[model samples]
Target: MNESNGHFRPDKWRIYFIYLIAAVLFAVAGGRLFYLSVVKKDFLQNQGEIRAVRTVSIPATRGMILDRNGEPLAVSTPTWTIIANPRKLWELEQDPNAKTTPQTEMDRLAKVTGLGRSWLQEKFEVNRNKAFMYLRRQIPPQDADEIMAANVVGVSKRKEYKRFYPSGEVTSHVVGFTNIDDAGQEGLELAYQSSLQGTPGKRSYLKDLKGNEILRIGQDVSEHPGENIELSIDLRLQYLAYRELKAAVTQNRAASASAVILDVKTGEILAMVNQPSYNPNDRSNIEYDQLRNRAVIDLFEPGSTMKPFTISAALRSGQYTTESIIDTHPGYLRFGRQTIRDLGNYGKIDLETVLVKSSNVATSKITLSLPQDTVWNLDYELGIGSPVGIGFPGESTGVLPSRPKWHPAEIATLSYGYGLSVSALQLAQAYMVLANDGYKVPVTLLKQELPLDGRQVLPPRVAKSVVKMLESVVERGSGKRARIPGYRVAGKTGTVHRVGSKGYEYDQYNAIFAGIAPASDPRLAMVVIVNDPKGRKYYGGEVAAPVFSRVMEGALTTLNITPDLPEGLREVRLEPKVPYRLAQGG
Candidate 1:
């Protein structure tokens, strides 16, 4: 070693160079330490939290769908969804020597969840790369408990809900059901989905080394439960309608049928039911055909049920009266190439008699005499060719002539309930106007404590006149069979030809009866429609009117209304009352 001066000293440049290198290294290390402990401290903590934190849902129960009397029509039951960590399942599959191989674990799941083994395996294989997967949806809680007891690795259960329709196929078309995720698919459920669905809550917490997710869970937010829906439907009436309609359908071998009941005072739908209903609870083999709420969604030519409205239009013009005489003697009238005929001529009868007879010739004479716009305006006022606004899903606004222009033949056809279409709901609403003394009440599925404000349609006198004519119909006219024993029922029969691609299919008819009961003081209006009955008798009076009679009888008796007919004249019915029940828990 060379001395700096006289002695052997360490090399000065080498010493300086080593000191410089050491200082640079110290600065670099210090800067890195500062960056880690100060600048990036929050970032690192968040990373750690992200690894340990868990998210959880605070499930909210869906709302109950209750009838007007608070009977549960649709209810949500506690259930569980089978979930799994596919990544973990795949990891288990890769290990041939593992005690719980993926197949073994899946077999246990399949057994508990009632899923096929092949399905489980195929699903798992397809989702091998996925971190999460839904194995099954809406299993009974007990089933989930049994599955959880098995402790299949990577598999778990999450709390959820399932919709159960206690009324089953009876109220299936009205109350409807929900999907696996609990979304409404049809009927009132679909119509009031936003209000019926509840908000899901959230929770977050940190995980410990034991992997105990339950212990680590902490609430971050609370869930809001859904609001209960009180529908205008009367469960008793619904059952009655459903039972009778089903009976008629089976007896007559009809394609389908629909029945609706309305409160005359408030315009609330008392009951609505349809045939060809699907079970919402068991949708394994659901066909789209069985899902329609035919009462609200199906449109048909209303035929003679529309005659009362035509009478209203005529009387509204002040040019006609109930006693005004019309000659239907020839029993037919020629308009262009079309001939409007009566079932049989009633000689020369009053205008009211025309409706009672459902005479195509007489009603046409009266309608053709009226101003064209006046007839169309009457239809518009009656909620025809429009939504009744009962808030049903896929509700039909039935087809009407796009323009005001009506050919002479078209006007004649319109007079006799042709060249225009209407839904059963529209028919019901129009009858409500007659029942409410010419007040066109807004039809609603929701219950109202008092009758809501409605536009005055016809004069009270005209409305009473029409009702009188309808009473005549039930008394001795085509709708005679619809008469209730203790009640003076007023209604009309409609047997319209079903229109097809080529033209009207005369052989295929929609039999319908529209009536308001207790003619002494109106309370209920009902409509019954039987589609394409293949029986020997296809008249509305024969098919649809009978259903109306039974339903009105039951409803009247159930509501305990006093007999409006003379004491000795009240007819006796022997039908047993059906009980309403709640959804059964498994």
Candidate 2:
């Protein structure tokens, strides 16, 4: 009886100890639950939410570039980009029994998307460890749809924007092109890239266990669309000028060519063209030389076309008059060690006759007698040796040697356009000074609202006399080929030897013509340049003047300018000249 009683007492003590331990554990668990649910509840909830939410960037649409007449020059079109979940692709690769390998997937993608298999393979290999990767960007909607329908594992399609140039090569130099990422690359695109590129916005949302967007946990942010740009280019005129310039380059077998048409009164760039142009849509076949926009980028000695400036400057300085005579007998003048000669010998002649005959000797004598300040100051005012502020990416500030840098012969050479350089655009703008009542208006490419005030660069009487002389050039001088039957055209011809690595190449000449139509009341100022024409008649009158005539005629007609030619006059013919071989250094 004593032994059984002792055993029961021990068992009861053990039961009491077990109950005490259980009570302590229950209180500790209650305290922990209170701390987590009440004290740190907001922090714990935020941590869980962050793990489930993701923010994504939404790209905005790029701006459109339009011509002055509301024609589309450059625009953006909706496209698609192919993305991949690299982790999912890796998982498939790890499965030995999987039907496809990463290489096979890439090959399939390349076949459907017209991309190289090697390129896709490299991209896939680089992002094998990443969860998301871009397989291709700027894909057309049709191609994107095909890829989507194929049900390729780990692949997704996102909408994007791609640039579209409807005018193609015709407007390439003016409107420019954009890159694959929808960023502006050249021309106006490069000039206004910041204003044309839109701002991207962010979007955050919650996804469920299956990765489906369930609820909108964040506000929808709005994106800022890019501002549209209106240019001063006229699409119809631009096309006409491009076609005519291209025909001239091909017919003359020229190494290159360029043209620019400006509104005399408004200083608006109506059309600009360059030969050996590239199709922005198919950049794969583009050559570096063909990509050059020669109208604004190239500078060359203007030859006889620059004669008017010297004569104008002399007239403005009261040093010479339209009837002032210069003795040009012997057709040449010796200055220091250099002797300058004219294209042909002329005796004593007035300014008008000098211009009509384009006598280099006469011009050299006149410019040399003038003050150095007159020459330098006149060039600066006419926009030479300076930017035109046309808002282009690669405009050249043509070289006009400073006064101190001028040699005795330099002034003579510059008088007839051999020692200095000027762009086709600058030439056109300078001519506009004579066309617009002796005022030099600032050139612009944008569609401005108000008319720009003109700065007087020459006297009205002097400008009128210069215009008459220019008319005589077209009517009876070397620029006769530039005449249009139904219009009164005034211009000058320039045939200058091209400077090479060693010296001037004799047969490699730049044939150019700068002109304004309806001399009585000029409207369009056009400058045409044909470089290194391989033809027997490599003169500006033979190679470039005819092109100017045709382009100007067409452009003026398209713009509905009234005809101002004298009755009974007929359009000049453009007969192809015999091809000439390029000579060595002149």
Candidate 3:
């Protein structure tokens, strides 16, 4: 309180010092503000945006799979995936102001999700420190809405898809199923995955302090929904084939079975089914073995079903005709240590009679006389030992022995379908050649606008002659059971001893039948294979041919094909039509 002036006055130096301090402070603040607002503006703004902006994925819907008739085979249903931020949920439970605990909300969630309370508790405990966890996957939309309406803190639901197989196990092997992520896993679903799958889009948005979306920044990419697939399969024929094959399998007590039907002219698969099929929709107790598409994936000896091909090859050689006779004396022939035998001594018989009797001895003689590679070339042209070209997964090209030099015994065995192997699909395709007048059309699963162009493999006259000869087999030979009323049926039967770890199992056999319907003007070709029948009737004619008869009758009628056989000549079908619901899917 020192007074320098005459009156009481503050110190002049102290006032000047206070003003200088004020100027310096203001200058520093102004400089810092200028630096932040102008010089460092872009960098600071980017950092701020980084903290506030969030990117989210916009899910795309998966495509549907339909039959040729527009019936749904595989479909994607809108579902939800429940997710939770465990840390946030735990924090909410600890907050005193919170109205409900995580446990209570979780209990509510469990009831709606069909999950046990103990499971939810375990999940909560296991992921308590984690920021995110899946609560339940692929729950119904209604259930998800109920859970979201509860507003259980960090718990939220995400839109997703669940694959549903409308035809269930009937069409499981063909249409296949998708994983929880909506990605295909098997069958046509896996084959056309890229085309059927959709591209997901991205969206950016501004989030608030509480992690709520404050503003949408617009999508960077537009979502592209998956493309729909329409298969060549006819659901009615698929159902018919599946029912008949399953019934035969159960009746024969077979280990497994497969059947395939095709449009002879178009080479389009109309129906394909396998026994012991697993439901694509429910896989809780699924067996991996049952998931195989045996029709296209499994290989077996085609047996006498190859006889027609041998005859066709022989006829094409110009050395033989339908009337060419082969002698099968004593019913057996010795090729070194291996002896090829027929059911009985068929004496001297014409080529048509050889097929009717299915005489192995006669076939071996015919094959031996033909030029080398004649049968092999014909088999190759017929798609034997080749992929069916339907783009199915794990399709076996089958085993066609290609050696620099072939043994006479090897040729004989191949003539009887022992050394070579082929899939049910390949067998069906080969028969399609005969049905389509020797033209080799490319087989497919996709629907066609018009019949695709086909390459000629055999002379049309030869094909027609074989088709006519096959009719006699169904009429009086081992394939009598395959005879269908009001239709001139043409088919061949095959019975092969299943090869095991050591050699062919004498007791176990594969029964097979392949044929065409309305033989006068063939339209449909089919093949049925039953493996390891435990019943007494294991022969192709006894077991597989019966299934062929029923399915062919139904398919012919369904297609509205004209009955070629006169009413007087058409015998009354002794077997009653099996009762079934057309709603079943294959």
What does the lDDT come to for candidate 1? 0.83
TM-score of each: 0.88, 0.86, 0.88
Q: Rank the candidates by lDDT, best first.
A: 3, 2, 1
Write one digit per residue (lDDT tens) for candidate 2, span 1-586. Answer: 2466664556777799999999999999999999989998998988888778767778888888999988988888899999887667767767889998776776677777777878877777788777688878888898899988877767888888888998999999887788888888888888899999989878888976434467776687877888899998999989998998888888888989999999998899989999989888889987778767889999998988988888898999998877799999887788776677665568889998888888878877888898866766887899989988887888899998886656758787778787789999999999988899798888998876775987898888989899999998887787888888889889998888899999898658999999999788999899999999996668888888889988888988888888886573764654453332221000
Better of 2 and 3 by TM-score: 3
Q: Which pairs clash (backbone N, Cα, C closer than 3 Å) in model 2?
A: none
lDDT of 3 by residue, 1-586 (tens): 4465555445777799899999999999999999999999999999988789888787887788999989999877788889987787777766899888888877877776677989988998899888679988888888788878877777888888788888998899998888888888999899889988888888899987556789988658877989999999999999999998899999999999999999999989999999989988789999899999999999998988998999999999999988888999988889788777776678999988888888888888888998878888899889887787788999999989898888988888777677889999999999999999999889999999898887999999999999999999888777888988888999998888889999988788898999998899999999999999998677788889999989999998999998998672466343332321111100
Shift of residue 160 alpha carbon in model 2, Å: 0.3
How accurate locally, in lDDT, is each candidate?
0.83, 0.84, 0.87
Worst 10 residues of 1 by lDDT: 577-586
